[model samples]
Target: MQNMRIVKKPGYAVDSVDRALQLILLLQETEWLRIGQAAKALGVAPSTAHRLMSTLVYRGFALQDDQHRYCAGPALHPEPAVGAERALVAAARPHLEALAARVQETVNLVERVGATARYLATVEGPQLLRVGNRAGTILPAHVSAAGKAILSTLPDEMVSAVCARQPPHGGSALTAAEMQELQAELRDVRSRGFAVNLGRTEPDLAAVGAPLASGNRPAALALSISAPLSRARQIQDPAAVEALLTCCAALRLELETQGRL
Candidate 1:
């Protein structure tokens, strides 16, 4: 325990505010937290933890579910600025171009909107039978590789809410069995750190995608390599997955570094 020396600062921290901020950070790291867990983590009494959590809930920084578990609130993920979409596209253009060059396939940057994903930017590959630009097209999130990549990063409840509000575009409502199957696929995507759409969005199209994380937070953005189904067999190829992941990492690093600015 010699390595655990405690330093007492003179005039820096306030205990209550510090504890509240710590709770917020904890919420960021996990899907949900209970009062007992928060109290134990912060070395506070249960009453104190309850008070702190109540304050957060009142201020919209946290939400208390029916089970009394605390989860992050909408306030934690603020809406982007007025022209933020354009800025995102501008920052991502070069990276998308590089990815398309490396993978020899069309690359796209997509943003999640409700239950749909809207293409924000795209870079086409050199292949003659390449997928076309989808810069402004919107598609069902459950059927798009990029959408699945982004969705896999969200909590189950939030995903369910989005699905409930905006069921798939052209199909009958999703049955409970279908929802469970989609959840399983998202779990697989989470485990593999990427997602694939094998002719699900369009019969002739296939793609592989990975989510972009900003620090510890999952961004609403994803990047994908799109191609004709014939060439898209690469979706399952380890080499192709590696290439897509590499590009995703590069883009994530750039976004993180720029965020500091």
Candidate 2:
């Protein structure tokens, strides 16, 4: 975190542009914003707020739902997960269970929190020698299977912004060369539709992961399956990959049904 605070606006800032962006920020914070609420927040008239939001809707940055309340639009959200991570995880549990059962490995639901991937849920497989549950575990996004999997879906500049920070557990920031290497790996992940971590997180653990929804908007969450390194190959086998992708399809539909995709 920075040590000192800078003013919200510089002396030469443009008021209209700043206000428009402020409305966007407000939409990010609030699940559904009303015109009156926006006006109250911006210190502007209701009509002015409506006009500004209407313009946002026209540009696909905001949406006016059937209730005439405003919400962040596809262009602005792309993932529908601002302040909704818990809901998304709740919807994903069943699918994770199905995947774990099918693959007989530990399944993890990971949310990308800046440069770290926080495990939201986990389902352990039945094998005697299997990867343990990781619900609530946090790992460097760059070094995590699910994290790298989701990062592959973003643009290079955005990836840089995400991995530009230090690891959540405490470490130096990623260097430029490391970012380049990770970007290269991400390019491969994008083409393959999955990512792998071979004993990267633990000495005896290996995993495979992919974005929650492929060929669509970027997802804030990813699904991964882990197994003991001695038997990790099974998780990457064709059957496991097929099961994982099939589960992703089902989970994506659930999210869409909830208006979260």
Candidate 3:
């Protein structure tokens, strides 16, 4: 006769509260969850799961879509702005270094702050004519590859709002015509999956940049490679573009896997 094994169910010390907390954690990681799915996962009745979800929604800890699926709410992620920025820079540093080495050009990690792009981290290349370290520098977003790349991922209305509030410094004041031109350029950036700066921000300097997707939200961060115009001929080359995209993709994956995104 063959031996048979039986599985036993474990009892929870405080089932309802434990299940509710578990649901919150689940919603954080998942795109959406249905009550039935939650009940099954928690080994509870569907009605019990529904009540828990309703409480979470009432408290602004979860949101239900038109389809009645639940997703994470704003309250679940309340990290302060400065803390978030530091975390983003810490997560991007290694990838930026690797990309700089591969492209033989300076690499920067920047985040959009109002109408400016703040350079949070930078890695200088080995080349003699490479761009200088841009860490701690802030530049007008409309004229920067990293800033343009991030802006390209945002809604048009939000981009318009930012532009209307702050014009690029020491450059032509933004007029309606200039805004239209910028919109066209952003469209091209979205289509090409990257943005380019051709001596726009700084003379004889160029860069190519791509936005870093933040899981379910619009990208707030970007990565870019900068080089002197003499060596920037390869900016649009297949290898250089591939390296930039590949590096950004890897960085995004790492952030998502670490539950930081």
Q: Whole-model Cα lDDT per candidate?
A: 0.80, 0.81, 0.82
lDDT by residue for model 1 (1-261), tens:
468868875487898999999999988888878999999999999999999988877555676542467777555876765256556678889988887888889999987877877677789998888998766556778789999999898888877777666333333556678788889999999899889998988899999988886555756889988999998777658887888788878877877777721
lDDT of 2 at 141: 81
Please give, for residues 177-204, the per-residue lDDT of candidate 2 as tens digits.
9989999999999888889999887888
lDDT of 1: 0.80
Once fitted onto the true fold, the runs of candidate 2 whose alpha carbons sit more than 4 angstroms away are 1-86, 214-216
RMSD from true fold, candidate 2: 16.1
For model 2, the run of ten residues with the poorest summed lDDT: 58-67
Q: Say which candidate scores most in TM-score.
A: 2
Q: What is the lDDT of candidate 2?
A: 0.81
Where is the poorest 10-residue window by lDDT in model 1? 165-174
Clashing pairs in 2: none
- Model 1 clashing residue pairs (backbone): none
Measured with C-alpha atoms, the lDDT of residue 32 in candidate 2 is 80
**Runs in model 1 with CA error above 4 Å?**
1-82, 167-172
